[model samples]
Target: MTAQVQSAYAALRPADVVLSPDDLGGARATRHSFSRSLVRRAVAGGWDITLGRADLDEHGCGVVVFDVSAEGHRWSFVAFSQTIDESDREDRVVASSWDVTAALVDGAVDDDDVARLRPEVIRQEQGRADERTLIWTRANRSGRFFEYVVDRLADGAQPEPGVFGLSPYLLRSTAFYSNGKFGLADFERFEHGHPFAVPYRAHMLSAWLLRELGYELAERCAAARSETAVRLDGDWRRYFGLGNATGLGMVPYVVNHPEVLDAWIRLRELPLADVVARTVDRTGPDVPRVRTLLERAARYLAEQGDTEPTPYTSGAKLAAGLRPIQDLLTEYATYGTMGGAIEAQPWQHLHEAAAAAGSEVRGVVASVLTELADDLDDVVEASLTCQERRDIDPKMRCGELRGLIDADYDWLREFDFTDPTQTERFWYSSANNEEPRRAYAGVDPGERVQHAVDVARAVHALSLDLAGAEAATSVGEFLLGHPWHRGAVARVQSVRDLEYAELHANLLAGDFLPLHVQRLQLAVYGMDNYNPQSTDWLRVTLFSGAPRVADLVDGTADDDWSFTPQPSEADERTYA
Candidate 1:
């Protein structure tokens, strides 16, 4: 379709660009402290699973199923679980009997269809590529939350949120799937009619569907206990969200899809920089907006369930700094004013004050402010296109070779490879090339046989060699003399900003650490950030609190792919 057709294809319209990091940081101050990063911040804070809303945990079953429709467009989740031996239910890709395995079908399965497919879906490999399928997935139960919810609900009671002592709302976080990974809809299905618009927010949508499907499975299994066990009430049905755990595998995707990632990161960065840069008073329109934002954020923080909440000292510092700012602004402010007076850039002032207080709340504050700026297709619409398709002009001058690398990136050489700690860590793919495995120094077979694709070090080393190369030669010609950097040279030339992409530390050195490399990639992908010094920590957030298939019918307006609050006829509360 033409660009015009695509723009107006379904229901594309202009809306706010999206929250920026500065605004996000300011918003964070309204509630918590810590050098809040736009791309990095605490969310979902816990593993609580409730349906529809955070409250009403008593009726939760940690499982939900989607009801299928006929147009070949509808989808459903079929989750399976049995009291399997924990040893048999490992989370590895090779495990045969996972605690949960699911598949999406072309059409709704009646009792007969469901019965037949149950065995087939359980046969994950057998159904791995059924064309009509959009997504297929599984998760080993928390072993704790799974059994706890079942026991309590089976006994006609809600699971107390204390068996594990996490926030009551965060009990059911585990695993989920999305897209047409196995037998679900092809990614194209989501593109059809922009059906996924608004209600479809990536893998989380599927997880939410799985949550409902999980509830159904639990209800069916529990029906043997009592027919009354089924929660048929509207309120009972409207509670529950799914929790997911992802890992290092997600890091690469952010690097790969720069546009989408950039949309999120750039919007965050640009906005926060904008808000924090301002240095004015609180007499303008933003004062009240910030006040309301403070109220909501505080409410959100209170409502927040901390399987792990932002640290208290951090939270206190943020709160301590922000209240005074808000108070001052409110005292000097008028209602409904737009920007603060010429000198009263209240929003910007908040950033400055926080900065003085050593508050790094700018990230979350950016998110809050992003919600305020009423225009942002540019921010949210940033597309992720790979720019690594350049053909290296291997003919540049030798002097030019060293010049570009140093100027573009202050490439410098300083590392001792003989140190075991530096080169201690190694990355190798599984025999299948799917999972990435890390090994300690001197232990892994692929240590000396490692991939020489370390862009930064390679570039720096190339720079040093180029400087020493016979002069009066072009970079392309220099490559003829020193072909070792062929790969590095091509890569450096293609990527717009190589410095932003590579880890500064030398992996070959005894002090080489992979945690920062992993963290940076994860942060870029919008994945939750953590210090995974062990490389074993890998969890991602998907389908946590989003809409399901039903919303596709009822939710007409479209902005982002999120849940729309059903509007009352009087108020016309649209989700978009």
Candidate 2:
């Protein structure tokens, strides 16, 4: 890391600000978000996506393909579409079928490839593919919005922007399988110099292509119905995104990938701190840009409407909280506009002011600050794509390991394992599909086979074992006598220096909220309009305000797509 980047790390917000579940859960998408970064890279690299073929019938059952070219490489998105009854459409992993199944394959797709992939892709989990396939995914049409848009367009009228009052997606992708799952290529196969070299970029790109396919399917269905059928307006087209329903499977992922989680948190927090420390020039674009972002965020929040009631924070409440922050920013902007000297570290002051409101508002402020730290993009990207490896230092003295735990794993001491509530939940894989599941310890079976997500308990146990060992004994020597501590010891030694590597909360605690962890992961993926459907699962939209295919092709893409305000009837005339 450069000296400038090191300074940013030094200024990172306190752990309470950066790692608390409440604050992390409230995170909004910033420019560094995976989806946003992918789009920016796509535009910068002059990536092109074009329709390859569409062979659908009136019922919308057929094959559709899109060819994506980036840099010197080519890939194809092969989609198999079929109409399914509403009852058959399920988001649970246990479901055996979906409305559409697709694969993002390496190189150009030919007739034989499509024919071969058709049956396999439809089989989903039971399917098999070659190493050429990068991503395997499936989606179901959004019952509430899909046909509504199709019918409206067939009737020669644009759907009202309010049609997106609940969601802007026509299809909800429930799963994206990659990284060598079910015969697909492992990440290492293409991680070096591919367009999707960054982890999960292929998945995000697949989701974006699916969004485009959804638009195409809707248009095709509409055109079949009437001669007057029209395509979606440009503004509405860009507004449409891909919906996703994530469940308990993601919770274990967050726990298992501590290094990745740490990298994401630090990348976001450090840039925010750097921006906050900068002297704000009221006469410059920074103040106005921040003000604009605040206004856009408030408008976006106000426009959000949940399909069902959720216990999590509602958009309306967030919007209400934002009013005060917006008012404060407006005052600051006005003071600068009136030739008054702006306060030093005005951005920091703004952040401090937002902190007083709550974590949600504080996160919003931090996201806006990150947006202004444009110079840190390369640093952020490098950190995200860097190889993350956790290796045990077997030669380290047991006394040193114990001290490391005491200093870095201090949060582990908060939990009392003697209490049943602290050890109530256990994570295990379901037999049906090996899907990750959480269940109560005594009431549920499979505790014996529980996954090792209880880091706090493991470290606590390791600390006790270390106390009994000789202080001068090396970790390898101690582990030989207590093999179970190897995992704990390695994790401790690996992440001791990574400040944000461990979540401070106990995953097995009775009061632990899995949705908070899920929210944090989704926020990093650049999802928006969080709607927690249950304690273990929630719905979110990707690329809601993202540029459409035409925008990218025409070089009209806008970087300022985050927190998109809802379009209105007036947009019809404005875009026209």
Model 1 alpha-carbon drift over 4 Å, by segment: 1-83, 105-127, 151-202, 215-241, 252-264, 270-289, 292-343, 352-360, 377-379, 385-390, 411-422, 430-434, 448-453, 470-472, 497-576
lDDT of each candidate versus the true structure: 0.43, 0.83
Separately for all candidates shown, the number of backbone clashes (residues 3 or more apart, or on different chains) is 86, 0
| lDDT of candidate 2 over 44-72, digit per residue (tens) | 88989889899999867899999988999
Alpha-carbon error at 526 in model 2, in Å? 0.9
Which residue window of length 10 is worst by lDDT in model 1? 30-39
Model 2 error, position 191 (Å): 5.7
lDDT of 2 at 472: 95
Best by lDDT: 2
TM-score of each: 0.65, 0.95
lDDT accuracy of residue 150 in candidate 2: 89
lDDT of 1 by residue, 154-202 (tens): 5565433224321111223333344555555555454422324311233
Query: RMSD, model 2, all Cα superposed?
Result: 2.5
